[model samples]
Target: MKSNLFISALFALTISLASCNSSNAKPQKKVETEKPDSAATTKIQVALLLDTSNSMDGLIDQAKSRLWNIVNTLTTLKYDGKTPDIEISLYEYGNDGLSEKSNYIRQVTALSQDLDLISEKLFALRTNGGSEYCGAVIQDATKELKWSSENNSMKLIYIAENEGFNQGKINYKEAISDALKNDIYVNTIFCGNKTEGINIFWKDGADRGKGKYFNIDSDRAVQYIATPYDDEIAKCDEKINKTYINYGSKGLEKKRNQAVQDQNAKRVSASNYTDRAVSKSKAVYKNESWDLVDKVKNDANAIAKIQKEELPAELKDKSTAEIQAIVTEKKKERETIQKEISVLAKKRQQYIDTEAKKTKTQDDLGNTINSSIMAFAKVKGYTVEK
Candidate 1:
């Protein structure tokens, strides 16, 4: 009886131990993920070096007409919820009108945020039959331009030419090497067939700079599909222009140039005008260097530094409070116009998308640029909204 009683107690203790062990077991844990550092993001800098020999007239025309579309496409991109500041520099090479001693290369515009000034410089470009110095221009641009030292900034040099890439005194290989040393990717766009461009060493030029090469039909005219919203956007842009109160020495001249560019866009096509209007509506369209309204908004002490005589005729006699009130009124008006353009731009884009699907054509310089830029941007972890 004692042995049987001891066996029963042993069995009870074994069951209790098993229950305690089961209850003491730990639960499985979930894997934790780390967030990305947003500070790693940077801005984009683009230099367009175009061969402006007499044969490149069509190429120049396409560039002028499509500038707005390119600007608009860039505005769609964001890095870590912050929009990247864009600066574009323009260069014209192989134009006899330019000095041969300088390899027939002219820096039309320095890297600038002033989109209107860029447009003006582009429109002013006139082609002449000149020696196409591919190597020399690339070298000069690489060495002359102030490229960003930031590792994250996208510094690109797009050289568009129809001639062989090995032209001029400077060696193409060495020039491209210099570009690489500066972290500037030199992209080559040949105005011919892919095989032809490859045979001319255009592809090799791009490869040396660690960039892509493309061959495009430079003579192809840009086709525009007019949208119903184009008229309204153009009208809204005029209203938006009215809100800008010109101040400072350059303010009046730059403001006048704005209207001149509007006309130039219209000369190209209605679609171009509409696209320019859309670009103007974006935050990238800034005139802070000269415009009082833009300057004052960004700098609190701007008004105090400005000479009273530099103020616009309407604001010259006004008190600081009165000037501020005028600026406030203009800002409100500008915002309303921008919002309207934004809405219309969306509808215009949707219409464009549906129409683009039906066509079998390559885009002009604008879309070509947008394609290359977005591709490079993706590699840098940028988020393109469009």
Candidate 2:
């Protein structure tokens, strides 16, 4: 009888141990299941590396004129029916004003969502006499930028130069290979004849990096198509600017910069200015860091948490509820303005598209980048809304 009892006890002990192990494993499994998928929040990162040598002045001008158009194109993309975050980095190489130790390369902006800052830097670029080191600049961009690691994210590097691709100490082959390993495609844009570009290894760089190559007449000016709806869109832009409630330390400065960027776009051309206004109407033109309406949209309780001192002078004396009410009113006004602008923009685009079919215009910096982005985005399972 005692032997039987001892066997039963051993069986009971085994059951207890197994039960403990199962309970211990439950939490770990739960944790793993709850973990977020990094790929679900995909981003589109673009690096613009422009050769700012003396001969490439026209390239810079083209870039300045097309910044808003490129941005408007990017905002149309959706990943899995959701808009992905967009970031752009700028680099100026082959400028004598830049340090030789850095291979005449200056990172104008790190991969960022601040479109105004990108515009500011692009306009500030000035060409100077310097060696064009394509390989070194490519290597720098590949190594230095905080490129997205998600497999679904689109990472692109567009290097525009008129010089030989193999003009630096760093081999273009190795640099492009490293970029590919990081899932970054390096597109080469030669500002000259196609055959000469191919002979100078520009085509080879694109092929090896799994990107497109094109030769553009850099001296040619960007052409614009004016629409009847552009004047209404400009008026909407003015109204939308008034709806932004700037708060925080840099709020006023950023607000001023917004107007400055508007002026910059207008300085480019009436069509370019309309593009910027249309872009501001989209969801991607967020100014959450400074605009109270945007901040409150992301966080319902943000107004309550913000210190009075951080708020604009007009709102400093108001209570949290008052501030919230003001923000809500401004938000509604902005949305109305945005909707009006959106309608006008659609009409404007239709006009441009119809006009475009009538002329076979040569591709410029904006057209090349925009077309390539759509192609790359489709390959990565992103959809474009026409």
Candidate 3:
């Protein structure tokens, strides 16, 4: 009875141990969002805000021609195992700056890759009157434009108002509050004035919005491309070049691994089946271990009757060598693509430079006409912080 009790206790202990092991073996959370092909990772949206105040025609020209350069720069950029989500929205605020027009807060275009449309809109715009900067920020821009704060997405508002904020019924303070609420980055590019008060108001708006601020000197600015088309093409090439090198290489590596897996699986299966057949044969006849001899004989016979040639088919896997070759081949392909990207990028930059010259020509013309206006600004002692 004591022996029987010991066996019972041992069996219960064995069951308990098995249950504990099973529970411990379970994984916590299953991982979702498996890594996809290289192309699947890049996505970022950008908004370009233009200052259409009477003084920034040349600046606008630079922006139109250089649209691609900025995006191309981004292609070389890397994030935490992800690509940027790139989109562009064009908005010009000075349309209302120059006028009491209700539609002055203009959305030239929504988030898009069609940069040409933005360039065209920028080219078509004329600098005019009123700038209710705070209202544009607090009301139209922050509250109205399509953006998601929850996605932790890259949201930006590039504001280039030449003058200060004067429009919004809501005060500058309120605009800051709203910008913080939206988690928006408002990069301010001030062209004419570098002094405080006017430009500083825009600067503070940018600061509150958690964005960078830059003051571009008209004379110092260089147009990096000859045309908007060239800019777009170069920018695109830069992206393809950068990503194809990294992502394309990665894709090829995966294929190589797949090939190896295929090769390995075949060999493993071939060995496993061969061993199983041998073991069964020994057990049935050589050892006479099977109590059901006839049944064991039949099973062994059935196993032997199975086609051995089919074992190779079951075991056939794509070899690692084959996969490695594919990787090399893809790397070569990407190198070729990268060279093309470089050429195209160079051509686009040339266009940007050419466009700069043309825009400068326009700037010269405006400078001639706005001489009195320029003199008035100088005379007013109205200087913003440089």
Worst 10 residues of 2 by lDDT: 29-38
Candidate 3 lDDT over 1-386, as tens digits, reads 99999999999999999999999896779778886544344334556667676666666655643443344433433334343445667777655444455445677787764433443455567766555364454456666677754333555566665566544566766765676577665556666555753445766765666665556554334322223343333333334323221112233343343234323322333322221221111111121121112222335443233333322232124353443344355445544545554555455445544665665433321232123222322332322111
Q: How close to the true structure is residue 119 of candidate 2, measured as C-alpha lDDT?
A: 88
Instruction: Tell me the lDDT of model 1 at 199.
Output: 97
Model 2, position 352: C-alpha lDDT score? 92
Global lDDT of model 3: 0.47
lDDT of 2 by residue, 225-320 (tens): 888999999999999999999888999999999999999999989889899999899887898999899999899988988888899889999988
Cα deviation of 52, candidate 2, in Å: 1.0
Instruction: TM-score each candidate.
Output: 0.88, 0.93, 0.48
Candidate 2 residue spans exceeding 4 A from truth? 1-29, 33-40
Give one digit per residue, the lDDT tens place, for model 1 in 1-386: 99999999999999999999899988668787764354343668889999899899989999998899989988887877777777899999999989978989999888888899899999999989988988898888888887877667888998997998898899999999988989899899999888999999999999999888888888999888889999999899889989898887888998999999999999999999999999999988999887766887799777777789998887889888878878888888898899999999999999998998899757567677888888988887778775
lDDT of 2: 0.92
Task: Name the TM-score of candidate 3.
Answer: 0.48
Score each candidate by Cα lDDT: 0.87, 0.92, 0.47
